[model samples]
Target chain A: MDRATLELKKSRAFLCLECGKCTAICPISRFNNSYSPRRLLADGLFYGADNLITNPLLWSCLTCQLCSQRCPVDVKFSEYMRDIRAEACRQNQWGNASHGGALHHIMEMAAAPALKQNRTGWISDNLKVKSKGEVLYFVGCLPYHHDFFAKDFDYAPLTAAVDTVKILNHLGIEPVVLDNERCCGHDLYWLGQLEKFDELGRLNLKEIEQTGAKLVVTSCPECALALKRLYAERLGGVNFTVKHISELVAENIDKFEFSEVPLKVTFQDPCRLGRYLGVYDQPRQAIMAIPGIEMQEMPHSRRGAICCGTTNWMNCDAVSKQIQHSRLTEAKATGAQTLVTACPKCQIHFRCSQCGDESQKVDINITDFVNIVASALEG
Target chain B: MAGKVSKTKKKTAKAKFVPNIVAFACNWCSYAGADTAGINRVQYSPNFRVIRTMCSGRVTPGHVLKALKLGADGVLVSGCHFGDCHYIFGNYKAVEQFDRTKALVKTLGLDERRIRLEWVSAAEGTRWGEVIDEFVAQITTLGPSPLNHKPKSRK
Candidate 1:
């Protein structure tokens, strides 16, 4: 059988019940009537591979796994979408890339074998990071985002990276930060540029291997998922154990003392962290461990969380804005002063949604969960 | 066999390395400046291609990166002088975007000199020629872009 057929069988999309639960639960489908995961599956099954490969709606799916989570038959629609997107990429049918595809180009460039990056300029003198260690902190694309968004947005994404190291230092573990580390290729993998993704993955795995790190940790959910799960699956398995910083923080919450934050915040569960990696609790545990901080759960929290509206930095349109606006509104309705999220992309997207005209603006601060935890750290 | 070998050697010797440079010129200033250079018959390197945009701000990091990725040896972004922008602050915006683009290019292991930003007013015909000649020479000295390859010819 062909690759599409084989992926279809492997994803179990053939057993779709047409219950419309995936559609009803989808954050995109709620706003975009044209997009439905159930219908996409039906189309895949009935119309064969050719039609499915060219379907523009294929890119519209957030792959947030909201549908697959609610599906009765347990069809992995998101994984199915990923596989089909790989085929679509081979056919040169790409989604409408956002930011004029600059981010994608950055990822492609990161895959270059001779790439020498000054990525460690952000590492302050106080935060002790070694060239190699038992634990490696994967600072994925935060420094790049810092420069890219510096002119327009007030958000400081680099804080998340710095804070992750700071927290690690407080725990008495000086993590390894590689200056020559390439991107984790999470965005490339989701965008179906598998070859470039593999190149980046191999480069990263090789670098991490050279560090002799038995444990890899990252603050970004996408990076964590890529390093912890996707790399192993695609690159024939990584030798080190990968952990999100939240997991590490939660595991050793008692070691450090916290100063009073005294802020009310609601958590935004990044789709990769919560659904893909099942890391819903660790971030919350770390957040709650902070003294004088109150955590309010959004209506759709944990596995049922709504995405930050855009993924892979592609297809960010009115539908994405509406999804972000609604998610922000939900956070605001929870009576929280700030919206805390584990992923840097979530903070970026949320802030982008608020940049609209006054009517569309939601008045709530968006911050990285790591930043919050770092602020509470007692030096 | 001796004749064929000599012919190949002559061909290689005759072919001088010509760099493919992508130039983004503002419609109001740099594009008009290039036209002025042509009308004045100013001598300059002919290795660059100009893509005109309404404003310098329109030449985003994506455009610059795309040019390099698609095998351009270098990229030149020409705009109006800072305070003289047709649109109040479009040139300023271009500066911001160019800075970000340079950071990305540097991180990706490309020499930051491969991309440049300059200001050329509509009347600077001689200056336009000078800019092109200098950039072309610089790129030639730097050699071909690492990403450069013979792109597939389209029918």
Candidate 2:
């Protein structure tokens, strides 16, 4: 390390005693033995950009905060890696090639009015939906982008969401449809593309503002949290309210009834919507309100919930898989007939990993909370 | 008359030797603290140039790098204390970025002494002055960044 660089690490190293607790509990290390948090920190402190930019391990972190949670001194190894990744980006080093380019492509698509305005078209014609209302449903990109490539993934949820809008219509809660709704920009920010995030945020805010819709509901937890949190910086002068569709449905629980489906269900909390954004109770309340359904808790629930490995924002393939496997195993151990999650990303990732393995045999039913609520409504 | 004459001459020399410092104060805390300093007349170095931002977390590593790259002799980043942020932990995020960038800067052979992080609450205007005084003195001792070592190739 250069003298100046060493001088800086002196402080960082002073605070970080190299206890290796970060490496010990790291979920990434469980799958890929090649990943060493101790080495990454040492390289960062000793080698600077040389090791960080060149090492494939630097980009292999899922940033699930598992290490941060376990660290005794709060060293924040994952965030340190994020800085290294940011520097790599600045130097034109394409660390994770798979999803990095796709982020830019998605941003371009999100900005186009033609594409954004037709977002609701992803729903089938058989799903009866009305156009004007005070509530607007923002169905996020996963179901639209991946289609049936995900396992046990049903587009029937899209119909259910439309059915939710119809139920609201029946209740005299006129919901306005922002057919021009693009992404709420969670992916762009998570992908480390702040500029693209700003553009997408502006577009979404503009479209949402045009609707004059007081209540914004979305099927995606990531989008809900992003709209509620991230846009405060991006659109300083604009203000609006956002709610997950489940939260909306939970608020209106008395208006609906369940047919007592015999299936025990465990709910998966999306990271952005849960720990990262602090939306835990609303989703759970919605799940529990369903009559005759036994609610099961995953070993890791709420703020401690692990992210699905397929976060377009992060590029830690090895660690993400490790987390996915752990979460799937835990959810399966609950003996719930189905594993349910609110985010489309979560739905898609779990489906991809299921792959019909007999040992890991468990039925995965990926459905949004609103879909369940809409279906349970006593027509 | 002789004592008055000597004091005026000393003041002029002290003013000429004081380092000129520029600060990018986040709007939430540091900027309000500077305003507090002005209201309280804390008398810090007039050397600082404060640019206000909504949150200190908004300060990207690129901004700090560019400021140093663009010839700011010394940079001071002040934000709400950890957990006290108006946006709740935005400054903590800034803390993470700064920790790495500060480390990165020293690695690139830059003077690590020229950049620092300080937490100044909206009520701590005098603390802001004290921080500026310390930063200005440190930069004065170190001189301009060595990154300015090379002349523009195009020029």
> Chain A alone, model 1, TM-score?
0.98
The CAPRI classification for model 1 reads as medium
TM-score of 2: 0.60
DockQ of each: 0.56, 0.01
Model 1 DockQ reads 0.56
List each model's interface RMSD.
1.7, 18.3
List runs of model 1 lying over 4 Å from the truth: A1-3, B1-17, B82-89, B149-155
Report the C-alpha lDDT of model 2 over A96-185, residue by residue, as the tens digit: 644324333444445544332334554555444446546676666643343223213344435545665655654556566666666677
- Whole-model lDDT values for every prediction: 0.89, 0.66
Q: By lDDT, who's the top model here?
A: 1
Q: Which digits, one per residue and each the tens of the lDDT, describe model 1 over residues A188-283?
A: 888778898999998998899899999999999899999988898888888889889999999998897898888999999999999999998899
The collision pairs in model 2 are: A5-B106, A5-B107, A117-A180, A133-A174, A133-A175, A133-A176, A134-A174
Sliding window of 10 residues with minimal summed lDDT for model 2 chain A: A143-152
